[model samples]
Target chain A: MTMKLWYWPEIQGRGEFIRLALEAAGIAYEDCARVSGADALIADLDARKGRAPFAPPYLDIDGFTIAQVADILLYLGDRHDLAPSRIADRYWVHQLQLTIADLVAEVHNVHHPVAVMDYYDDQKPEAARAARQFREERLPKFLDYFEQAAECNDGPWMIDHRWTYADTSLFQLIEGLRYAFPRRMATLTPDYPALARIHGLVADLPGIRQYLASNRRIAFNEQGIFRHYPELDDE
Target chain B: MTMKLWYWPEIQGRGEFIRLALEAAGIAYEDCARVSGADALIADLDARKGRAPFAPPYLDIDGFTIAQVADILLYLGDRHDLAPSRIADRYWVHQLQLTIADLVAEVHNVHHPVAVMDYYDDQKPEAARAARQFREERLPKFLDYFEQAAECNDGPWMIDHRWTYADTSLFQLIEGLRYAFPRRMATLTPDYPALARIHGLVADLPGIRQYLASNRRIAFNEQGIFRHYPELDDE
Candidate 1:
């Protein structure tokens, strides 16, 4: 049976991470939200009786539903060899995934620092403060961490000579960050050679190359987590 | 050899989740920061070669280190039978744990909305705005989700007849939220009877009860994730 993924249809958001992984692995799955409407998405979510996902992008596979981007990736990684075979390597990769998730949350907060419910226009001043800190401290810290992780493995991949979900996700992270903070990312990218190499490698992968060139891949926009607010992007 | 768990010593921060799990499982582990000092904690973190933990509350066990609160709990849960044996059940509980982690992050953000480095006083206006939204929309959504999760399993535990790490973490979440937002939690607690019941069950667990009574269990304070700024709490 094909897997079913549920997420907001309009934005790449967290759902893109899952889409990239599934595409890279050449796994066939249905994007439920894109096929159905937003009402269907809400209805499917509400219909889930118990222990339902707090929010999407949740995946239903093999008679069970799983939520959280990292958790979904972990499940996919284990089944498709997108993670390490050894126990410790798997945990290490998972730790990396969690850190990436943290970065994603912070990126979202850059535009909506004061409150998710409030309009970005209402929180512009707060977002400016948040974005400055994110561009200065948080972005460098995360990029440096990943650069170090890559150095440990002598990699374009997180694990030596092997592309896993971490590599694919890192590719998406750098892409999103670049789009969102082009000026800042341009200034900072030169400092993390290993991350750049991995990003390049992930783009060159056959599955990813095809997926990106095809219409299935969504473009980054202001509505998503990584929004390119000109005022927020700085060197 | 005993496992060495490292975290900031002063607060019952994220480390407490790890501590609670270890104590509940009757596992022996050394609190490295408490034994040493914050300087030692920094040195220990900085000395690590590569692919090191991005932050504290990392556990060193059996020649490998694991970080992230939920990931560490998942590791301990698998080894100690604090989680279910079935694969689906494990994922379900993990999803719950991830949701708890999300709540913990938001709880921290209530006091530090603008930037983590910026003082709370510097961002009071923004925090006030953030807290109002948190208390109104975010908190209830999370609590309702967990309450439903608990209700799904006929609880005193997240899963029927079994207490997993999700239950323990939920216990801590409730305790911390109450500490951080006394007025708000008091008003909200009655609405989530299943969660409150699980919280009580966790407190009464022989391991947790003893841990709480002992000096080892740190008290909640302003320095931690759940800080009680009376201005931030309301009905």
Candidate 2:
């Protein structure tokens, strides 16, 4: 089966979740935009008629395109055995992924509190206040929720003994948080041992290890969602 | 079959989307929190172990609980034929619902830009700035996407000739946007005729018409995600 993933060629952003899943599952898919340039991605997106993606990070499987990180992950989890076998468990995994998506959106809003169209430099004061709330409240709350979810099962994985796409996404979420707010994360990391354990487990996976070391993984930068602005990080 | 929905009893928040679908489909459901109280909803949510909802607006069908507005809608769409019959169309409807959820989050943020936990009075200036950006850029972009989606099919609904859960949710989104940013919506609403048509179509559905007139429909208030703060609305 030929599968193609389209996203911004530069930043990890939301596409990283899809990439991590495909990599962890050992699924073979082409990164379309990365190979063909952003212009190709734009042209491809614009050319589509009905039922197109609202933004980047969409996967074209055989001919069908699936957009939205959680939606794409749901499809991947079901097809590649990244999710559980039971229907309820599968929906549970999707719920966890949706929650993770929520936290990710808030993380982006931390740096772009006032508006996405405006530059971070223009909204530094607002970002500072948002960062304080995110660091003190939102980050810990989301981490605590994930920690509870991880603890629900006997194993370190979010669902059963095996790792699901949620685990992989959670791993990326922790990595992004650490990168964006090192000072605050350093203080909070110790509190989420289950999450940290999952992070380590996902990293240790053969596929993930190979992908992270390879050039496929884009480095998080100011243009991406989890940007490290020192003024926005606090302990 | 017994279905119960748990959300804040007071406000027509995210839960309303689920409520709209259920109502539009003529599916019988108990407004659990509204009937019992907010404490009952809290206790029910807190009682769930492993694979629980992260927040309110979760639907308990039989005994299985489903959370996340989009996930809940997807389930309802399948069970009650509120979505398209085709798998691809169903996923398309889901993608649209998720985008609506994104815009809804932004609308909430417009009122509480700095922090969700903090009072709007404390962050009026930040909210003012956020509202301007939301009104100017994000709002139109989202509406344009939805308009295009609605236009893709030869009907007012998002998918095809028949209305899907996406149509119901889109109706709610337009209502919320109008409530939150009256002047801005007034200026922008005419541009997206497709969305306006969908909004009217969803409202006129027999089930929706009855529900809206019934006491089950919670009135929009300052406490809900969509609030009419005159200061935040501008043309």
Compose the digit string of candidate 1's lDDT tens values, residues B57-100. 99998668899988898888778888988888887888888888
Error of 1 at B21 (Å): 0.4
List the global CA lDDT of all models.
0.89, 0.90
* Native interface contact recovery, model 1: 0.76
RMSD of each: 1.1, 1.5
Error of 2 at A23 (Å): 0.8
DockQ scores of the candidates:
0.83, 0.75
Clashes of each: 0, 0
Q: Model 2, stretches more than 4 Å misplaced?
A: none
Model number with the top TM-score: 1
* Angstrom error at residue B100, model 1: 0.8
lDDT of 1: 0.89
Candidate 2 on B39-123: residue-level lDDT in tens? 9999998898876889999988877989999888877777779999987787788888889999999999999888889999999
lDDT of 1 at A163: 89
